[model samples]
Target: MRFLLFILICAGLILTAESCKKECHDRSNPDCENYDPCYGKQPLTADFETFEVSIFPDNWIPYSTDTLASSDVFFRAKEENVEYEWTVGSETITTRSFTRKNFPVGVRIPITLKVKRKTDFGCFPTDSVVAQTRNIFVIDGYENSKVAGYYQGYHTNNAADTFTVCIYIPEYSMNPPHEKTTISGLMNISTCADNKINVSGSESVGYKQYTFLSQDGFCHGAWGRVRVDSAFMGHIRIDYSYLKDLTDIKSQVDKTFLGKRIN
Candidate 1:
């Protein structure tokens, strides 16, 4: 009876050893695919909460970047009365949202969000998931702004070519955008137009007040800030002291002139 009991015990031990072989396999072994380190571990993921900001510049500004622009960004949780700490640069504020304005244009800032259970709510002193904050940028690059399209500038009713202004924005992929606030500045003044214009002797561009145009909307073309008089509300008028004589039948341009912004 003793011998039989010993054999039975040995058989039980063999079965137990076989069951633990998978768990005890070498972690470095390439063939050990049965081992899973995260089988019983819970997962933690970081997230960023999207909040609406009242001060973000969604459209292009017609003037300076110093103008006040405010927006709010914050994080929220499903728990009631949850507390949050917002961090940006070296500053940390204990609020659910933050508002900022006058940030330097072209500067990118990173923000972080840390959350904890509020004392008012029944919660433990444990830290919750901290999410990464969104990066921000100020309104910049008005000089190289995107103002691409065709326009007809008529300063006179007799002839369209006499005061016709053709605006063309280059392909953004091949060439960088150009900036100018004047008719001559936006054109290639190096070459003359069919001997009609002296490239070196064209008129200059002038700036005027947009309000004087008495128009409802505003347009800031590559020619810079446009100045439209009340009489030319729908169009731009320039009083050229002399004809540009720069004739381009291909483009239907008559004269080239220098101009200044009235504002």
Candidate 2:
């Protein structure tokens, strides 16, 4: 009886050792059924570019469900024979490239690209899933100013109140034509497009409308007429008011400034 019990214990230990051997096999082992060829490697990358398409506010709403203006974005993949998954805002698409035409202004929108190679299991090393994101900005006609760059000038209301104005587009590479102005050095001022100004002129360099809110709670609204001949020059007469409430207007201060593009 003692000998039989010893044999049974030996058999159990051998079975346990065999199970451990199978479970301990690494991906490099060919005999292992779960071997992986693309272990510990990122074999793919997702990349794309963007372009902007601006439209008038009156004719912007083509669809009832659409949010903002439309943009023509061109996306491209670096690798061939791969599956693509794109997430633009709340929408997902499997196409390699498509024009996404619904985004809001004055905000940053995220565009994501996820990809993986689609090949035979053992034909080549399996590619790991690669995901990349590029934040985009969609601009209306006002934001898409051709005179988008740095400028140097001073406020004409007060001689001692010197300031530098920067009219720029954020994330210039991925978004459509739009501009954001920042008046720094003297006082910190930011662009405020709460109220749109209507102006009629040439699309390239004519009349551009803008609104600015300073740190001192003053809202400045004006239209700047830019001339692009030998140099980029513009003058603006802005009516500023201390905006305790944006909905209601009261006391106002009028100021003027002339700016030249240094960059």
Predicted model with the maximum lDDT: 2
TM-scores for every candidate against the unseen true structure? 0.28, 0.34
User: Native-vs-model 1 lDDT?
Assistant: 0.36
RMSD of each: 18.7, 18.4
CA lDDT, candidate 2, residue 46: 87
Model 2: runs farther than 4 Å from truth? Answer: 1-43, 54-72, 119-126, 140-146, 149-260
Q: Give a tens-digit lDDT track for model 2, residues 14-88.
A: 999889778865877666767766655445678765533323222111211111223444455555667889887
User: Candidate 1 residues 176-213, lDDT tens each?
Assistant: 44322223323333332321211111112111221111
Clash statistics: count for each candidate: 22, 4
Candidate 2 local Cα displacement, residue 50, angstroms: 1.2
Worst-scoring 10-residue span by lDDT in model 1: 210-219
10 residues in a row with least lDDT, candidate 2? 58-67
What's model 2's overall lDDT? Answer: 0.49
